[model samples]
Target: MSKRILITGAAGFLGSHLCDKFIAEGYEVLGMDNLITGDLKNIEHLFGNENFVFHHHDVTNFVHVPGQLDYILHFASPASPIDYLKIPIQTLKVGSLGTHNLLGLAKEKNARILIASTSEVYGDPLVHPQTEEYYGNVNTIGPRGVYDEAKRFQESITMAYHRFHGLETRIVRIFNTYGPRMRLNDGRVIPAFIGQALRGEDLTVFGDGSQTRSFCYVDDQVDGIYRLLLSDYSDPVNIGNPHEITIKDFAEEIIKLTATDQKVIYKPLPKDDPMQRQPNITRAKEILGWEPKVDRAEGMKITYEYFKSLTPEELNKKDHKDFSKHIRK
Candidate 1:
């Protein structure tokens, strides 16, 4: 019998890519998503594949896996600020109740589970080049807290499951990842800049644009996640490219790449924004024997091409003017 794996949020940017990876490896893949922040277009290409099966269901409710399972990757959370703000309660429910529901399934099926954690847990971190050991300085009541605290709570319970239940669990702290399939209007920096540049709109920069962030390509992120699932790294391990860049310089690069004459506009920064973020992937290197091979310029080029393929109307409807300053409450 072939191995079967369940991937929550399988229609999402990273989740879709993971579905491709697992299917390519010859495992039977069960992709589950409620299409909340995820879109069907992202996974439509795989609909005809015999090895792939998709379920339009929310994991926050009960999940019923039909066949024998080998792994469960819990990645169903509203990641972007735009998303969580608009659906704060659903975001919290998915991360908290959804995770608990998945853990229950994992226990019954005896499958290894991987919970997708985030670098936000290190919120506005006091330490630079954040290592896995640094506890975060996060605002519990801030606009971004709904998403951040939910993830923090997710990690807490996942660890408890491992200690108390002896159910094998893995946690990966992902950083700023970008690629195709990301909603152009999700308010993430990469897609926002690319969308504006593509349409000849001024690129918005928040707070002088000096905040630093690292970017990891989708392929590299999936590579590290795959390694972690096969390995024994139960604690939360940071999986991201350690290459850090300023928001100003990043926008400048995008403008130049697109050869857009659009001006850079400044906006007020959101509350409790992190000044710097870079992952310390020393553990990933030593344990998973992995590191991101794609550089920023190369990754950006690929993502830009994907955005260029969309029609003007599609771009306009999906792209918003500017939501960087706004926070979800």
Candidate 2:
């Protein structure tokens, strides 16, 4: 029999790519997503494959999977600022409640699990080129705190489970990742700029656009995650490209790539936005023998083509959700 694995957030951008990766490797892949931020269209191509099965359920509730399970990748969360800011409580629940439930499930099945953490944990870092050893600088009560604190709590609980229950766990601190299947209006920088350029609007840059970010192509990010899952190291591993670029320079690159006549526009920076985000990938290279293979220019070209292929409706669509029903007082 083939190895069986469960991946939550399977309909989202990174999760959907993971589903494709494991399925291509001949594993029995179980995909679960609440579809709050995940779109089915991303994973629709896999429905015909006998090796892939999707469960449309929220991980915050009890997760039930029948038969043998070999691995679990806990990736269910509202990742973007637009989504989490709109539904703060749900963001908290998935990282706390959702991670707890998945860890429990992993223990029950004797499966090795991986939890997805993010660079947000290092909010507006005082340290340049963040490392795993560096404790982050974050505002617990700030607007971006909803996502950052939840991920911090996630890493805490995951480690606790590893120590107390002896559950096999892996933690990946992912940096800024971008590619196709990204929601154009999800409030992430890549998609935001691309969408504006496509719509013939001036590219919007917040805070004079000097803030720096490193981009990891989706393929490279997935490769690193796959390598980490199979490795013996259980501590957090940073998976991202280390090549950094400023927002202003990146915007000009996009304008040139798209050949758009629109000029760049500026706005005030959001509260607690990280001014610098470059990953210290020495751990990843030494441990997984991995470093990003795709450069920004090549990766951005592929990503831009994917966005240009979208229909006019999808291009203009905003991913706003009615979270009032899900929000608690």
lDDT of each: 0.91, 0.94
TM-score of each: 0.96, 0.98
Q: Which ten residues in a row have the lowest lDDT in candidate 1?
A: 319-328
- On lDDT, the leading prediction is 2
The number of clashing residue pairs in each candidate reads 0, 0
* Candidate 2 regions with alpha-carbon error over 4 angstroms: 320-324
Highest TM-score among the candidates is held by which one? 2
Model 2 — which ten-residue stretch has the worst lDDT?
318-327
Runs in model 1 deviating more than 4 A are 318-329
- Per residue, candidate 1 scores C-alpha lDDT tens digits across 210-253 of 99999999999999999999998799899999999999999999
- lDDT, candidate 2, equals 0.94
Clashing pairs in 2: none
